[model samples]
Target: MKVENLYSKSEENPMKALVFDKSGIENLKLKEIENPTLGPHDVLIRVEKSGVNPIDYFVVNYIPVKPMPHIPGAEIAGTVEKVGDHVKGINKGDKVIVYNRIFDGSCDLCLSGREMLCRNGGIMSVITNGGWSEYFAIPDKNVFKIPENMDWDLAASLPVAALTSYHAIKELEVSPNDIVVIFGASGNTGMFAVQLAKKFGAIVIAVSKKNWLKEFGADYVVGYNEVVEKVKEITEGKMANVVINSLGSSVWDKSLEVLGYNGKLALFGTLTGADVKINLSSIYSKHAKIIGTTGGSRRDLIELINLCRDCRVKVWKTYKLEEGAEALRQIMSENRDGRVMLQL
Candidate 1:
């Protein structure tokens, strides 16, 4: 069946979207397509901004998108254009952010508060058409109103980087006495990890080439090569009680070396590489705990939005919808300091 036929309240008007028929940036194109189909519990959003992330880059150049031609945005913020008959409390023109993870709600994982890992769920751009369009539609439950004081750029940037960082920090149970070290401190998730760790009162040591991490609340900022010695000196040989490594295998050894006995390490992304070689004694001798986290749960999302009401996040740059491809390209390019977004 045609994509338009899936919607019961179909509109004849066409909308512009940035899409790719297959996995490759060279295949990305901007064209007119039917607006997304809205079910009884759906809400139509006129996208105001779409934040670009490494996953969107992965979706465009590597991963398989279910629908042949797919829109590649997972972090979205916008206004309600329409609300289905069954949708309540959400009205036209309300500012909102997409939850990005689609869950069945009745699955075991969903019931246990792990909707991001639901038995029958998937991330936005990969499983369905996403928000790199003029208009997008999703289940009303997956959209939440942005706090009235939040700006378009901050709201759009939170769904992925901020939420993922928040979940990882929460999982590690950071506390005031814990000495925390965050690798990739200047990247998308890394930036938020710094702030959230500080908020929890952990003494944050940020690992990055940049010295500006202190502005985001890193108690100490050091280069990649300086992590071991610096962390040792800072802790007076106590080592870090928690290490947040989103960069993966390239820094795996150091991430482990910096951990104190009985410390916990959180793992999320693998921007460097996945495969790593580690001695069993290295883990056993230290009494280390390794946590693998992905996206945040619905509750985590709610908590983050509330906590970040007065918090600051960085938005590196903004591009027009026509500049979507360039916006994605910059995400993997050098000298990137903050989130890149597409203003619709």
Candidate 2:
């Protein structure tokens, strides 16, 4: 079918996307575009909502795209309108969430059940067109069916941020009475990390700016400058069993300092800068473990979906598709109180 025929041009067919051409953020625009085509292993989804991630802006400005034109978005929720012949376990009219990772499924990491680590993996927004538009196409394996009654905005917001939290917490195997320190607890992933660590029965000690403390669910909250001393005081010189670091270099040393003996520090994002200095003695003498994680596996996504369905966790806010750029801008500004979504 022709791309124009897939969407109604006479009825405000504008997609409302954030476009990053060669010029940069000044070139970012909200406009309509031709609908994307479905591949043999793909599904055509009429996007109901999309999630704005920090990486979206990073990709838009810093990361170089092969061509001048690109759509910057990763997570999305929508209804399936068309399915490729090989697609299975899903059908047209089903509500679904799309994962950004696209793997070959034959790589060493995929064979080891770590598709997110696939050396040849392709991320949706980074390597391909993502969910910034009203309608987009995705490989069948990249889509996870959502409940019919689930809010589209929630579905969109859950994938990227929530999934990252799930992987980090699950990998650490946090348990009751375990002291967990979450750095950057107010950001999208950090919020989910706080809740997920609590759900896993850990005693969460979140660290963020004082303004964001109440909403972040920390047993103790402190400013970035006071994190080490505050965390040390809260733990009574014991330190945390697990430290989840989202701020990267900015808090890397502090996170390491607050960890108890044999503590585990899971690094998920580098919202700060990449380069970091570490005290090898701290790690060596303590016998601490440092782990890194990113996108969730297919199985991890399934578990997260169930967690949301049971209402054990909740999404914070929703925005219309036309507001995608605004949502990204809000996230970039770090002025928002909750997760920002683009509803189609």
Candidate 3:
């Protein structure tokens, strides 16, 4: 889809919104804020649900581009309150999910179906006030209609975790019969990675507590301490075909250790740390390749909804929008397994 234009008009009425007028988590405030008016090419959504993420915490303290009194929420699902005059396919009162990554479709990367790599793209709720409010406006193209019967909170969680995992796994092109080892396989993205890899017909070995990830699609689960040794045993010395490392430097060396010849290592996050010392000799010796990934395209979001509808995506628990901060904390907690959601 193409993003033709994006411009918001100021509305006369104010709506409830969470604002951070200053830096710090304690500075987050919920109050009445001006509602964004609908642009001809935009769709105004009345926020129904949103999910929290660690990046939301980082963006609140960092990302200087967002002005004060900014709203922070990357995973948003809502109803179309109003459709811009020029908007199509979308209508008022439709249940929809927001494609949070805003990109200029005319850019080379965007036109090539690599919108995630588009230099002009800006993450919603970071570059501007987002779904923490009862009302928000975005380009018509950014709005996707979810099945009417779908749970808003579940759809809300899909935009970020589901999209990111889908992108990373697809980037590595995990194939059937491939020996796939996924690190951090219990976190939001990790769990999705486990399921998606299995869906692609790979034999998935998850790196997490054995009991925590057993309910999902993981063929086997092992604690990080024994991750490498266990993979070797499972593969009978062949090692893994692809290693997905979302935890970053913490497991970089180990991830490289379990890779078989021509193995692919997909790096998607820097949760533990960013910097890592590379072993050229190791990579060259194994003929391994490294691929970096991030957010997925809007098309992936659409596909994710279908997957969720088909029960391919799992929903573990949900919290109200009033408990959003706690929901963010839940994702970081050791006890929080699978996807955590927020109902508005």
lDDT, candidates in the order shown: 0.88, 0.77, 0.79
Query: Across residues 182-280, which tens digit of lDDT does each residue of candidate 2 receive?
Result: 888877788788878877878888777645555545566677787778777878898889999987888888888888999999998887876897889
Runs of candidate 3 with Cα error greater than 4 angstroms are: 1-13, 210-212, 312-317
Q: Between the candidate structures 1 and 2, which one is better when assessed by lDDT?
A: 1
Better of 1 and 3 by lDDT: 1
Give me candidate 1's TM-score against the actual structure.
0.96
Cα deviation at 113, candidate 2, in Å, is 1.3
Q: What's the residue-level lDDT of 324 in candidate 1?
A: 87
**218-250, model 1: which lDDT tens digit per residue?**
999998898999999999999999999999999
Order of models, best lDDT first = 1, 3, 2
The clash count for each model shown is 0, 4, 0
Q: Which regions in candidate 1 have their CA more than 4 angstroms from the true location?
A: 1-11
Candidates in order, TM-scores: namely 0.96, 0.88, 0.92
